[model samples]
Target: MPYSNIILDMKGICKTFPGVVALSNVDFQLKKGEIHTLMGENGAGKSTLIKVLTGVYQIDDGEIVLNGKEIRITSTGEAQKYGISTVYQEVNLCPNLTVAENIYIGREPMKNHSIDWETINKNAEKLLDLRLNLKIDVKKLLSSYSVAIQQLVAIARAVDISKGILILDEPTSSLDSNEVKELFKAMRKLKDEGMSIVFVTHFLDQVYEISDRITVLRNGKFIGTYEAKKLLRIDLISKMVGKEFNNIESIIKKSRDISFKASEVNFVKATKFGKRGTIEPFDIDIKQGEILGFAGLLGSGRTEVAKLIFGIDKADHGTIKIRSKEYSYIYPLKAIKEGFGFCPEDRKVQGIIGELSIRENIILALQSSMGIFKYLPMKKQEEISEKYVELLKIVTPSIEQRIDNLSGGNQQKVILARWLATNPQLLILDEPTRGIDVGAKSEVMKLVAKLASAGMTIIFISSELQEMVRCCDRIFVLRDRMIIRELIGDEIQEKNIMETIAQGGISYGKN
Candidate 1:
């Protein structure tokens, strides 16, 4: 409704890579003077579609129409020349440089045969003031500024290409409420000035607030586009996942079952586990061959519980028992010695050692458990890593290959292999399937099933209720740092989980 003119149009786009179909016959359109939102789940082909549009990738088929003319953007620079610019989720600006220097790094003003510092700072300040209503010391190092300010700086740089189409990808992921409001204000300003923008984000509230139109993608295919006001959030979610919300009954019945009786709790037991401000005192028990799930929204104390259980964070109260032996305070080393393995939520930051080889990372945690003196010989290390790589179906050229060079799913498998090498009695995986493709997710689920069937106790945590219902034998629903609801057998359904989350863990009756 903002404008009748179409600024950009991507039609019947088809893109593919080895072992993956990123985008297939997808169509996306953006109107002038409107903020269009691209919505999808992880591995929904949002990033691939964006890459194809921005010239980060060359399309295998279909055509792109920009301002009523067919255009093929082969590189980032060429995309910019065609009035298309992108500010990615991660700010790509140099942190050590000044705000002004970062904005105009490669394109600095030259005055009187010298670098024009005065002109650069002045121009940067002017741009920020006019576009984003931001007042900052442009001379200061960009690192000194907060992430919110840096996001604004990135936008200021992108919007400098006047009348251009700016693509903002998950810019609000790390921002607080006030910062997000300020960002929305800046976006509105850009919209008012007749600029077209493609906004990609996972936040539904933000999408409804800022987007004039919504486009949904699912499994490398375009679903449909609708005006923001007309499309309900529930419908959008169903479209993104290719299933209705009410049809989640299928998730409750899984293909795998616990090989050992799940009625007993012998593996790990938390008696009023509390970490003060971190997580409330709660009791949870798991059996040797049981898969327990923790489900909650962001900041709902899911990760906090995992940290407390894994000894990453010291418990302020309560006792943890492993195989009927109580430990009042279990430190990281002690947990490792006690046969506990933890795969952190953030794989890139906490799990993978980017510079190290797959073999090195796989054996690092196991080596720590054995102590420095119990060194694994190079040949033995290769065998251990090779065994897991093949067992886990990790696609790598060799065990010596750098873990960072592999895809996200492969890196996740490496993390799993690392934990598995220790032969831990209990494995705690927090959001293990995040940021991986659907194929990898399936593989990880299968692996979890296999492990549980092998009599290993596993704690699974995920934001996706469907996944929790599918894989977990029993689910503990947490809210505001407390165990509010526990679902078992017939109660363990996606609908039940959603009702608990929405209604403060009260039973909504059987579906």
Candidate 2:
């Protein structure tokens, strides 16, 4: 490849924040008409590098060359002027605004020095048609559309700017398979027209599907860049994780085969668990010692299912029975009192207490369960913290260390410890291993198995099919807000789960 054809280049980029070197001597290049993917475990400096390139952060040491010209980009506007735009995972457009208004917010087409609504809508429609494969109504309010449509609208707006590079940061996180296919088509169209694209995502399959080349980052350093087609999935994973992927499958199978006699007691039983317009009613049973897995594609209601069980949202039509007593409309406090613990999906937003010390965070759920005024004695609190710190192997200098100061993996462990300390009979873990490293993920999975073995009922939710297959004795597959299938015994495998998700029907076990 000719280096002269590079449209964007960063050399020896170094960024630091307080105690962390976010990025160190990283070099990245993007060529015109190519989709260059940035891949790494979360907090591997992918976001930091993007921030540096997009003018969100000024690099301490490095040079950025756009179109062979070295220029200073002190703000987002300056970066946009050089033809760089970013669309984050969350759609940042104003939801209340019309699609047309969102598309042309700052640079509206004007008529007679006044806002030109008609021409703006017409122009917005035209611009969208050029980039998007779907027909969207420009006059519709953004909130009226689904997440996939809103995301496409965001991309359409970015395409209208006609600039140097476009960065798509986890654009398909909430999109379904069909929606992802549509977005990929739009990306290809833009690439054909000579747009340099920087794609950031955790989904490995997507990286291979859409990218021309891949750049791997690990722990704030650039590992390597290679042609997408030339790299194997296992090799890519190994690079991202900094080790040979462990034989998680064998371990899980062994754990599953170590069968326990079915207990007469049910820890959690829901007759038709669901909320109207959110999740479809489905029956679920968690025995005293079992790890039940929830598996599905994005927007498949797996997380919604967890929410209903945890009482994050009220179920419109369902009866939950814990220890043979039926309860009506369970709430968070009630769920906790009834021996339930939940570790929500988004760790930063829902799981961690960033401002609190690790010990305090670890004891949050237990404290809530034991009533706020009934604080644990200092000695007992220290003992609880010490036990879990060693149990989960959380990497903190001390239990008193602020949870925010820990790495992503350690922070996740702290959250897990919080729930574990509650001593709940049923633990609900939603995407427990998300954004963590391989070693940490393995550790967490092993812990789940151990907990189940120790008679703690568990419900594990993950977007990764292989993880679900390896971790649970039974798996529930959901699609479009409904439970499509359930897999148990020997049927729990990656291929079967993917097929069930694709077909939207139960093949392995009865509903």
The C-alpha RMSD of each candidate to the native structure, in angstroms, is 5.8, 6.2
Q: Write the per-residue lDDT of candidate 2 for residues 1-511, one digit (tens) a residue.
A: 4223888889989999997899999999999889999988656899999988888999999899988998777888888888899999999999999999998999987789899999998888888887776678889999999998899899988887758589999898777677889889999988887888899876555777898999998889989999998987657766765544343343245444376643656778888766765677788888887888888655567888899888999988878888878976689999999888999889999988889999899888888888978988878888999999999998878999999999889999999999889898889999888878899998998888888877888899986666787778788877656787878878887656655654557522224
lDDT of 2 at 68: 90
Clashing pairs in 1: none
Best by TM-score: 1
Q: Per model, how many backbone clashes are there?
A: 0, 2
Write the residue-wise lDDT of candidate 1 on 264-354 in tens digits.
7577888877875567788877777788999865556788888988889999888899876898768888888888899999999999999
lDDT of 1: 0.85
Error of 1 at 428 (Å): 2.4
lDDT: worst 10-residue window of model 2: 245-254
What's the TM for model 1?
A: 0.77
**In model 2, which runs have C-alpha deviations exceeding 4 angstroms?**
1-4, 245-287, 290-331, 344-348, 352-422, 428-454, 458-511
What's model 1's lDDT at 290?
86
Please report, in order, the local distance difference test score of every candidate based on alpha carbons. 0.85, 0.82
All candidates' TM-scores?
Answer: 0.77, 0.70
**Top lDDT: which candidate number?**
1
